[model samples]
Target: MRAFRVLSHAVLAVTALLAAAVPASAKGEDGAPTEAGTTFRTATAVKQGQKATASASAGDYLYWQFPAGAGQRPTATATVNLADVSARHGAATWRLDVFDGLRRRQPCASGEPEKKAGQQDSSVTLTCTLRTVRPWAERWSDDPLPGAYYLRLTVADGPEEDLGLPVRAEVEATAGDAGGAHAGGGELGAPLHAGAVAEPKDGWTGGWWSDRWLWTGGGALLAALAGIGGYTLTRHPHRFRSRPGAG
Candidate 1:
């Protein structure tokens, strides 16, 4: 009996330590590091290739953010479990919006950014596949640049009763480098992110020169050659000769 008690206590102690080591948020069916933020500033940060999940009311907004480097295209896919089907009275629309670190909404290169789930359906999935992250882009352009990107998932329209009901959301964030073809030549004046930014592994340098500069230089050279030819053809031919055969 004494030996059995000692073994039992040791097992209990080890189990207690293991449970304490795991974060409370990770107790979900699928381990989630943290809860989704309600706003951009409070957005939960997820690492590249990592998945983030949260549970919130159907009416509440869920936000997650991930970092992307130049030359890589970032895509965010979210699966949302609507309120209990029995409580839902009608169809609901869910939207997934992606934004750069600057908070400018990024366009989805693929299909629609929203999905409609029927009242009988328990869940819906939405995805936002963004353009390739460019090394450098014009100031006025909203192109996806190297920096942090945010994901916002919210229920657009739903049954009145289901609005405040509990729901769960899961977001999978991934960034894949598309190679040099997608990267722009001109470097952005500044990264979209404020603090430490993710950069390409090979190295990224911008603001030096781009295809625009090359085009401009080529056009100028062609114009100069054209002007010189026109002058030569229209000018007095005898000006270069020695007085019409005196030579």
Candidate 2:
């Protein structure tokens, strides 16, 4: 009995520890670590396109920009992975907007694909397969100056739900000793896709709760209720046992 009690306590302690240690690694649809890369500090969900940060329920959007000096300029390919869209993955279209260091939008290559057709899309557009893992790549000709560039990844139609689905993005930079257009020219500019691999690996360090007292008190109450129920059951085994006169 003592050994059993010890084991039960150990199991509870382990459960609490594991729950506390749940790393905030944003999970993909398959629950695997999504393509590993630097996750920007600002992440939001929206239905419509907008130039800045905001939340949304539903609507087509213009574009969202990561802050200046926030991430690498996507010189090569920037992939957006959307997960858990059983409702509208195949129906929605995505437009990838690329901006230069000066925030001047660049035009797509001639006959380049696009997400959805719009008047401004001729300048920056990438048509992606609906609801699947999509890559909006900048052809070498479309490469902008090495520096901060905005990637406006937007999608139209496809899936609709009460909550916006989680999307993960990865930007792949070119690998070589050749400094891009900005190198050796006394230029402070870096390629759009540069420095992506240098992003930190560790995530946020804060605990689950901002205030300790509330959750601690709630947990204590739950533990007390469990203990009381356990004791009551232990004291009256006959209540749960088979009746002497009835099968």
**Per-residue alpha-carbon lDDT of model 1 for 179-223, expressed as tens digits?**
544546566555668333344343333224345556778899999
Give lDDT tens digits, candidate 2, residues 56-122: 2223232323212211222323344444344333444555555553456665433223444322222
Q: What is the TM-score of each candidate against the true structure?
A: 0.67, 0.31
Candidate 1's displacement at residue 88, Å, is 1.2
Highest TM-score: which candidate? Answer: 1
| Residue-level lDDT for 132 in candidate 1 | 81
TM-score quality measure for candidate 2: 0.31
Cα lDDT over the full model 2: 0.38
lDDT of 1: 0.77
Query: What is residue 12's positional error in candidate 2, in angstroms?
Result: 28
lDDT of each: 0.77, 0.38
